[model samples]
Target chain A: MQQVQQQTTSDPILEIRGLTQNFGGLRAVSDFNVTLAGKQLTGLIGPNGAGKTTVFNLVSGFYQPSEGQILVDGVPTAGLKPHKVTALGVARTFQNIRLWNDMSVMDNIRVAQHYRLGYGFFHSAVRSKRYRQREEEIAREATELLEIFELKKYADEYPRNLPYGTQRKLEIARALSIHPKLLLLDEPAAGLNSSDIHELIRLIRWIHDRFDVTIWMIEHHMDVMMELCTHIKVIDFGQTIAEGTPDDIRNHPAVVTAYLGDDKI
Target chain B: MLRRYSVHLILATLGGLVVYLAYNEYLGLYYLSVLMFMGVNIILSSSLNLVNGYMGEFSCGHAGFMCVGAYVASVLGVWLFARDRVFGAPVLDPEYALYAFPVIILAGGIAAALAGLLVAFPSYKTRGDYLAIITIAANYIIISAIENMSAIGGSRGFMGMKGVINAMEDTIYLPWMPIWVFIFTIFSVWVIRRYVSSTFGKGVNAISQDEVAAEIMSVNTNKIKTITFMLSSGLAGIGGGLFAYILGYVNPGSFNILKSTEIMVMVYLGGMGSLSGSILAAILFTILLELLRPLQIIKWIVIPLVLIILMQFRPEGIMGNRELGQTFPRLKKFYRFK
Candidate 1:
């Protein structure tokens, strides 16, 4: 709850400078950069295999960049593991919606708060007051988060049993369980129906307004991005081609060419 | 809060009853040995369950840790507390053995845990079949190392712990072996049950489910693996200590690949991710082992054949990741999430 508490600051919540990732001989993400301010819902759009997911991987600490630095709240995360990066107030959902599918939906969310737990193993073994207090708090907070996503009904069910859209929403809810300052969504709307997309857009906007977190999403759906994102960045072949407001990105020559396969625009 | 305290109270009373029965000779020697075997299997299977079941990693070399614990405890028992045929007189008088017994067992656990690090660190870089190989190698290495240690009687193996256990008996008039075995068995299950139910323990489940997602969610997968392995191996060490005391002798041959396989069979039979299942399966497995003693070498063949048939019919094992409470509605009231 302390992490979700709003702190007004002029500083950007995330700043990636000269980030580049090379997988063997191929340059997957070349010199990618972005500065995300707190509470901003930004979009990153590109064609398939445009290194968008690779960029997400690098920023999220799934892969160490061959070149560049990622600063979360102005701290370097070059050598840190993904979990350590997450502990520094960054959380992410996968492109394929990776939830702890065997665990109940409520457990999926509660498990994300592993680091936030203050009690030691001995304390829990003895069922000390501190363990009971912390556990009760986690259960309460997880249930509240599930309710926000309209997932209270499925709390006892495993994530694998949930509908696809609900699973996606649950993944987002799990990410939010970290009470992170920054959230990275990789292809959030990749396989959703249009109605689900609309609901997702509404949910994203609601989250941007309600939670004190910066949101950077990789979305293939242009309508969702145009409808929800305040700023948009376009990439092609691992290179950033344009960055500006959604309208500006939509009109940029390189951006239109990258998506439509044309330079005459 | 009252329910929690009552649970502990009930457990304590039950434990007291079992210890009392064994100490007073109300139970025959053969039955007592069988009960003690059940306790050791409970410790072994449940500890292995922490890694292979709850953590969702395959480790087949668990007996190696048991060997380490058994040897360390045996040596320390002779050197510090008791006289022996091979090792001569104790460095200290037998009067101190009642206190020294636990310290020796704990030392064994610590040593086994240190040995566990060898496998745990390598596990970070590998998984599945490769991890299995690593664990197998670790098992062989521990056995071979012990066999080669001439100072500890090498391949002839060592015998001396009977003197130490007897010293403890002389110090306190109670049934030392059964009582200690009972206490350690409860401690093992309690530690594991408490672990898998806690928030940090949930990280182990998360790693088992999806390592990448768990990492992005701030579950330290590497650290969790290390801790789980150490805890698992440490408990196995305690089981080994109890085993050495019960047998009054130990050999590298006793803690071999076959021993590890038996523990693995118990884990799968119990079902993965269910602590109660592990405990139940261990009891049944120990009983089966006892019943099969007349079968000689044929017991191994029959055991695996039964396991194969069981896999065909119910591949998830008896509990199949569901606890006894999940299957029986009447038992639900007694179920705590841990």
Candidate 2:
């Protein structure tokens, strides 16, 4: 018994439509549409100038869409801030590796779980059993998150001391601390070494399969895109030019030109 | 996990020292006054530390809160001390005046906390240079408002704390204002040190690191600002309460922008997040000023030149955000018992 959705029947955990985003005079993203189904790893690929990160910003509410609709789990979130979007179960990492550099790695992860902590002064100051319990719970969770990202050895170390690749993994572990249903990773593999990128691809695939989360990642890595992504969306400047399996994205002439300078193919 | 017995051990040592000092009443008075100054500096640094160190917001108006606390406490002290004297008889006999000290200081703390609430609101709305102006404005407002109030010896200043001390002397045959000032100073430091290590305190540090991230993670930043401001002001008020008693006078002229600047200097010099740094700075700063006072006007030139030199080498100030124990970890067990 197949049911017809009033809109689309893709059963998307996240859906964006006609999202127009302007940065001062530049229309960074225009007529952007994306749908992410549950537990699917989707790639958002294009040339450097394409609106991939802009779309993440628009969806994350860092930049307000010039005009459009953003729906998370079928709920409209057109006018909201980043934290508000985060509260609605959409967590993101940054392209520039936005982290609390002075803080310990464990603190970075614990900070994300702040919303989950229910203890106030009465519970915290009085050392009530609940506070102690919650404290232990968060520590355990932070440890597990560190283990997942393979950053347990650097848990107590500050971000400034860690290697660049480890810092990026720490950033993802921090995002995972929020337990988001939809993860928006903006160029997670941007500056990773070859070995680290291999681990990242495996990790990203693992997270999708295990957590039942929909991952929408902006990346320029063809190998990562070809390896992990079930489907790919290709955009040029501000408009989507192609949407299909990875094979379709590879063959699309506009996406091809956007990357190779000219369609030699 | 820290124990009360550990606190008592440190207290007993300080208490033994205070007893030894009390044998010489004249020197005891000087020591008590210095101790009071040290306490005030602790409050100044610790509260400002909440903004400047733990919270990472630059504020320059500690003196304003001190003024607010001072006037409020002084007015209450005068009102209570005046008693039937308002009807021109002085309802509270001189003998009992010493006992009223705590009440007057509490009123000051509450009044200053209210004033702190005002500063906290504006702080949330602005940062950097804009916040600096707001603090400067607050300082001016407190000063002018105090000067305008003619009822309490406006510009010429007010006295009578000496009378209270005199009363206590008559009652107990005490040696120079008792040992409570030293006790309170130690207590203030201990409380702040303990609070800073707690969960609520970490939130302050988290805010200093990244505010947007803090809010997204549910740090309740606005509420923290309000509470932290109130707390710092309350501590400043405690300092004022002690200052009033120490000098045996209350004066608006003494609590000005310059005074606020002095507190700021102490906080920065001590190291923003370091409690022990402030405590040490307070002691050193007071001793430095006293030692330099013999140089009179020339002291200003030498001190500023030295400070500028110090700044070049240590931009984060003498302690540079590290606590005494952090800098000298070997002292941990002996220095802070708990």
Candidate 3:
């Protein structure tokens, strides 16, 4: 927990301390802590029911922290609504793909860019000159984001018609439109092929570099977890068992046991 | 682009055509008043559509807000017409009557917006079935509260504006309230359609699709909900205002749960999120209600039967949540050539 504090002060984008989430009688996540540095990818990996998603829920304001401190950019975030938290530059994607399926793909991205693209009442309501300019800017930005995700071809179509891989990328693209300081991806590569995984890694790296956004990824794919995350945190039964670089996490005795069940790493 | 401008102009021209057609063919006093009701219903349905269809929240208290608008508008009309006489003379000088109606209607919209703010506040914490219940409760509460207000005549109802209507008729031999209805109906439809297509309405759709995802995307769901709710309720208020003028009386019993259900039917029948769908449905609903008039009380049976058929064959309703332009893009394209 103290180390979580130190991380917040020294080279940290997000710091979680003494985090605990209990589902009725069950302790889904208890006394867990993780630190994500700026502009780097951190992987959160564990077996089923290891409370990986629950931790993300706590940090993202989907679920209030049961007993923990979440500091984003050194500001303690307690009791802030999800949108307020998002405005503070922390954004996330769900494990289940959640897109506005009925709306145009362009609309999905533009809505995300809405608060950022500011204008006045006459502009928006009466189609004032400023509002028109804002709309064009929003459209351009949305189109640009769509193009990057390789989804420009389907810009006019709804998300429901999009292929699974493209949908995932579009989700990421929508998140980036907010210009967040930290991005939390619940499971980017969950149901993707090796080819898709390759594309996702490149995209993630590209986002990290181009957008200067820190990423905290929760993924079951070992290869993705091992390859992308600059640092790794391993959780088991709601406790942090091992925490280090990918190689350190891979070699940690408890992590090896957690993965291989007493078999050598 | 200039092409978009031309497209807008063409749309306006078509709207003009619809108004001309309605006037040329359907302008008797009774039918004219019905046209006013139709316009009001269009505003109500489209506004409710924003919350129920576009924002995808189940709001069942539109009539309650409409009652608020009606009472406020009527009260203001009475007060202003009194000319410092306070509670006297519900109608002022004859020629100025048109001015009063629009003022009352606008006041009604603003008052309804306030009521919407109240309903919207609680919705921030809940959604789906629970919110629906709150809205329904709000509807009942508004009706009951208004019914309890003795100053407003309570359940007995109130009247004042007939003198204004009489004055207009005394001056102009062939005064038509339907003309006002047709124009305002056009105004209401055009405003809602354009609003929904703009960037702001994109937020409404975001709330419907995925609220959490929307917030994370930097879309302010709370602001959108609040604004959308107010706008939707305000439109319902305007509908009620027009309704009051059309009926020449105001009563709590008039805008009951059945009225809210009526608007809901129109919205769903038109397609949940479709603006043009609501208009089409409102018109069809009015006509169907009239056609079933011969059946008398049996019309209620036919209404549900049509709803059942709608659900079975095309649950999306007549327009399936699509606008006239969206449903038939070719219609829009054809007009655009001009």
Off by over 4 Å in 3: A1-11, A120-122, A262-265, B1-26, B82-86, B90-97, B167-176, B334-338
Indicate whether candidate 2 or candidate 3 has the larger TM-score. Answer: 3
In the range B1-338, model 3's lDDT, one tens digit per residue, is: 55557756765685566556554655466665665677788888888998999988999889999999888877776655533233765445646666666766788989898989878998888999999999999999899999999887889886665655565555664344555565567667766666777787678788898887777676677888888898889878888877776787899998899889888888888899887788888888888777788999887788888888989999988887676777688777544321
| lDDT of each residue in A139-255, candidate 3, tens digit only | 998898888777889988989998899889988888888888899999999789999999999889888878878999999888888889888888998989888899998789998
The alpha-carbon deviation from the true structure for residue A51 of candidate 1, after best TM-score superposition, in angstroms, is 0.8
Greater lDDT among 1 and 3 belongs to 1
For each candidate, report its DockQ versus the true two-chain complex.
0.72, 0.32, 0.60
Clashing pairs in 2: B84-B90, B84-B91, B85-B88, B85-B90
Q: Write the per-residue lDDT of candidate 1 for residues B149-239, one digit (tens) a residue.
A: 9888898888888888788889888878888888889888989988888887888999988888888888888888998999999999989
Q: Candidates ranked by TM-score, best first?
A: 1, 3, 2
Give the per-residue lDDT digits (tens) of candidate 2, residues A1-265: 3344666445788889889888889888889887777788889988888888888877776677789888887777777656667777788888888778777888888877766677764455456788779888988998998887788888878998988988888888788888888898989998899999998998888888777578999888889999988899998889998989998888888877778787355
**Candidate 2: true contacts recovered, fraction:** 0.25
Off by over 4 Å in 2: A1-12, A23-25, A64-66, A73-81, A121-130, A260-265, B1-7, B23-26, B81-104, B158-191, B216-218, B333-338
What tens digits encode model 2's per-residue C-alpha lDDT throughout B123-224?
Answer: 777877887788788878887888887777777776666655666677776544445456556655655554455455566677777776665554567776
Query: Cα lDDT of all candidates, in order?
Result: 0.89, 0.74, 0.80
lDDT of 1 at B222: 88
What is the per-residue lDDT of model 1 for residues A1-265, given as tens digits with 9 covering 90 to 100? 1244345586778899998888999998898888888788899989999998898888788899999989888778889998889999998998888899899998999999987888766787788999999999999999999998889999999988888998999999999999999999998987899899888988988988889999999988888889888999988889999989988987898887888887555
Candidates in order, TM-scores: namely 0.95, 0.86, 0.90
The C-alpha RMSD of each candidate to the native structure, in angstroms, is 3.0, 4.4, 4.0
